[model samples]
Target: MEPRCHSWTHWADEVVLMSDTTSRLLIEDARKALVRRLVSVCGQRDLIEAYVGWILGDKTKEFVDFEAAALASKLRISEPGRTYRDVAVLGFAEHLSPHLDTLYALRKGLDWMLGRRPFLPNREPDFEVDGIALLGMAVGILASGEWEKRKESEKWFIALLAETLRRSRFELWDRSLIYAAQLLITKESTAEREITPDLALALAAKGFISVKEDYERKALELIVNQPNYAEQQVDVVATRLAALNWLMRQVPTVLPNRAAPEDVINLLERVRDSLRRWCWEEKPRVRKAEAVPVKWEILNEYHVQDLLWVILAPIFPDLEDEENLPSLGHKHPRCDLGIPSLRLIIEVKFIYNGTSSEFSRIIEEVASDASLYLSNDSGYDKIIVFVWDNSRRIEQHGELRQGLKKLQGVREAIVVPRPGKMRA
Candidate 1:
């Protein structure tokens, strides 16, 4: 049997991936704010996942270890299947521009080989590519020409596949293509042009293909004639087709005499809206209860948010100052770990909850084994629970204030357990 890939996760180290200190600080504050808002809205504080998931449309772990390992082995050798190393080397192919050409290069090879379309790879060694399924998805969106439905399906497929990749870890997951196949049917509607012939010609000069037919041809050519090498590959190609089919149904809008660019774009959006509408109508909504995720991953503090920046920032000046760091801001931007860094972190509780003790214990554990915790971040500096009593009840419950005071490291812990309570 081939050896397994590394068992560690990129998210395991909290601070390494961030671009800079500002990004780290912003993420920290965003994390807390997200938690706080979640608590107030859902009657519980730890609902950040649900909130963000809703926005990201419930993307879950998609890639499996077996899939990674299989792909990894194939990566070292010249082959059809994409490997984990291939994906990593792509350096975030979907989002980054440099990776776009690499992604296209992979697609070209797969497209040519399967279609017998005569593509040469320049025959370089160690030149693995992005997952074909993923590239198909991008093509569905970017190259989708006259088919609105296909365009929509492509979007759905991409989102689903991206989510799958995000969740794939070291453990062997069910490496199935069922979900991948379903992406095409979910939302494909149609492809319509947004630019006038004049503006379109300009965009074309700028490398944007504005004509619907041109896009359709490109999208189709990518998937057409590729023999079903594997069920996974086949499904991906089918999914791409589904997105294209949706695009075919869409009615292209024509530009009126001297139509403004914005107007043309708006007209184009109508086509996209039509695509989504058709997709929604196509799916048979499951009335059954959602199968509870038995193994729902609970992202620890460090995995979800950077914890290394917490302790070391206090000791080492100029620790987290970099250009690309995402700030701790989600709903509201707060905290800057630059120039003036945070000496201590604080958490405020609306109702007197048991979380204060939990926070204290976690912090103390980290502080006790500073080297161990610092080496591999174990989430959070120290948990300090502060109770804000909006309703008059602090005096009614005398023990609340006393409990906050006893939590070890709390500087000025308070329990305004009264109606007219206001203290910072």
Candidate 2:
């Protein structure tokens, strides 16, 4: 029996080792696939920089190569009139170079790009490319403190960037670059203001972009079907590489997990508090100098349910209202609000009077509802009861809540008083 026990322990250890080995092999295979794709699409300078950036972060040797290439290309341009497209090149070079010549070139390029200097008659701007070039130029100017001396130009540059971001139908690579640049600018701004809305919108936009598709799986599909990178456009190839680089950097990091049961309870409690505030603070009617004030009231449970739906729907994107439950014997019941993702059901209750019997009836009704709502087959595992006490029975709330919590499947019980001001 001791030998058998030892054999079982040895088998479990072997299984654990095999599992770890399999995970490592899968990760290594994925890394190799990404590297191969990067190698095949090394034609563009940005593509090369992206590949190097992924592998070495900021210490990549391609930065030196990129600087040399930029300087060489700038030297070949004989005519000052043709330097409009050099904005990105000069901007990047300015970031790298300490010399006065690179700064002069970036200024010239910015002038042409921003239309302070006239372009040659035939050079209609590709606004998408221009947007990307402007992003690079902004980085250079910010790095060099050029924006400190030219406040008006800085304003124009920011306006142009904003307009371009708003109007341009850029591909994924250009769009991502613009979004990332905007995020960085917002982060580094010194202005005293509320930046949460701006930051939230930017993050929401980034999340929307990243979650639109399984990019790694899509990249693998492209690799299998289109073996020849020569056939694809340079921009398309760069976009694919950029996406894979993003995937590689992001895949290892974990996002915040879904809302837990405790979090949902806390959120519902906040909602309950908000309802009380609304009841107490909201003016019942607008009084004219000579006219009588009109009356307003939360007349029924449906009104409370509707208000709760309005409050909770935005918080939980998949919140279902009036979701029907399967029949239990002769009675059919519907949950007021259901968050399927959290496996939570919220039932709204309204009391007409402050009578003890009415409060007792609420406890009984909630107890019965709990059994009907929660079952082995039902998807929902937790229930929250929100009671709006229109009769303003603040005294009975503790008893009501205690009674509700004693019932099976009831995770939270919130009892809010109707505003005493409404009695006037």
Give the candidate number with the greatest lDDT: 2
lDDT string, candidate 2, 1-424, tens digits: 0111111122221111212566446544544444454454333444234223322222234222454545643653345545434555555554434342555555555555556432235766453345345545554454333333445556665665566655556654455455544543444332111112222222222221123232234343343234465555433443443443443343212224444567657766776446444544343355656655454568899988887877666655556787655333344457788765456789888899779888989988988888877753235778888998988879889989999998898989988777666673
| Clash count per candidate | 50, 0
lDDT of 1 by residue, 1-424 (tens): 2233322222222222223576445434433332333222222211122112111111111211222222232243256564323332232221112212343333333333233211135743221122333332332233222232434444444555545445443121112221222222242222112112222222222122324444433333333323332432222322332323222222122322322323322422243233232222222355557633232121233221232344334433322222111111111112212211112223334443335464345345433323221111111122233333434454433555454445544433433332221221
- Superposition-based RMSD of candidate 1 using all C-alpha atoms, in angstroms: 25.5
Best by the TM-score measure: 2
Tell me each candidate's TM-score: 0.19, 0.39
Report model 2's TM-score to 2 decimal places. Answer: 0.39
